[model samples]
Target: MTGAWKKFSAQAGITMSEPVVEQMFGGERDPQRVADERRWFAHEMRASTYWQPDAAVLRAATPRIVVGIGGDSAGQLCDRTSRALAQSLGTEPTTFPGGHTGFVEIPDVFATHLRTVICEG
Candidate 1:
């Protein structure tokens, strides 16, 4: 997944590869945390394969606002998914700077954008 993450980060317009890698594999002494992460990953995989939500119920429960990653994330799968989700939610995804790790990679800008969105709602 290292190569994949690198590709993702590149598309995200961020380059904290060392920190990302360390965060992913650094907990050598924390067996419990590792085990928990494993369980969560398994659960996520299973859920992704089987989970489906009712659209009407989802629409009723969902907020109408959406913000999507801009810049280098263009043409990426995550961007496409974000657009699709916004469409399903009956709104367009507003573009913000950075990508998947934008909150971490560009915290000040991302936080400002987030505040603007939240305040608008």
Candidate 2:
């Protein structure tokens, strides 16, 4: 969890004190919504756990994965679950701007790296 917080701070260029909840959930926090989020987290965790044996996750044989992890609420990548997946893949995890969300915060940087990884890697 601490690592996740640090990751978020580094990627978003903000401190843990920042009130950026809206970045992920759009500031919605109703009871039903919280329950829904919990349910979805469990469901997604189950799904990601299933990928441990996946040929793809296991077959990063020589693949380079540029990780984009948002904050804790960014869903799968933004959680420790993705760290496990990354470890299973045996690749160095690189952080980019944004969390479970895409590179919307800094799309240009993401695009540059994406292109570099595609062409130069």
Candidate 3:
């Protein structure tokens, strides 16, 4: 799973430092933590497999839709998907600080930006 994380980070253009990797794994000595992370990944995979978005509902609510892409996530999966969604909605995505994990990495800045976006609407 750690290798999977590394591969995913690489594919996503995210450079994970040793400390960050360690933090993700909950320290080198914690096998349970690693297992927990693997379970989480599995759960996400399962959820994604079964999840489907209703295009009609999304189109109907386009005016209230606020597609946000991370500033540093250019060309990444989330960025591409967000752009596509915004395009389909006849709108543009708003850029936020950092990448996909921006909210977790820069909570304060992300929250502030989110608030501003919401207020502007």
Candidate 3: where is the Cα deviation over 4 Å?
Answer: 17-23, 26-33, 46-52
Candidate 3 residue pairs in backbone clash? none
Positional deviation of residue 56's Cα in model 3 after best superposition, in angstroms: 1.8
Q: CA lDDT of each candidate?
A: 0.66, 0.55, 0.80
Question: Of 1 and 3, which scores higher on lDDT?
Answer: 3
- For 1-121, candidate 3 gives per-residue lDDT tens digits of 6677877778666787977876774345567776776886777755864565776689797478888999988988678778987887788899999888799889999999999999999
TM-score for all models, in order of appearance: 0.61, 0.43, 0.75
Model 2, stretches more than 4 Å misplaced? 1-57, 60-79
Residues 69-95 of candidate 1 have per-residue lDDT tens digits of 565577665677677777776877888
Best by lDDT: 3
What C-alpha root-mean-square deviation, in Å, does candidate 3 show against the real structure?
2.9
User: What is the lDDT for 108 in model 3?
Assistant: 99
Candidate 3 is scored at a TM of 0.75
- Give the worst 10-residue stretch by lDDT in candidate 3: 21-30
What pairs collide in candidate 1?
A: none
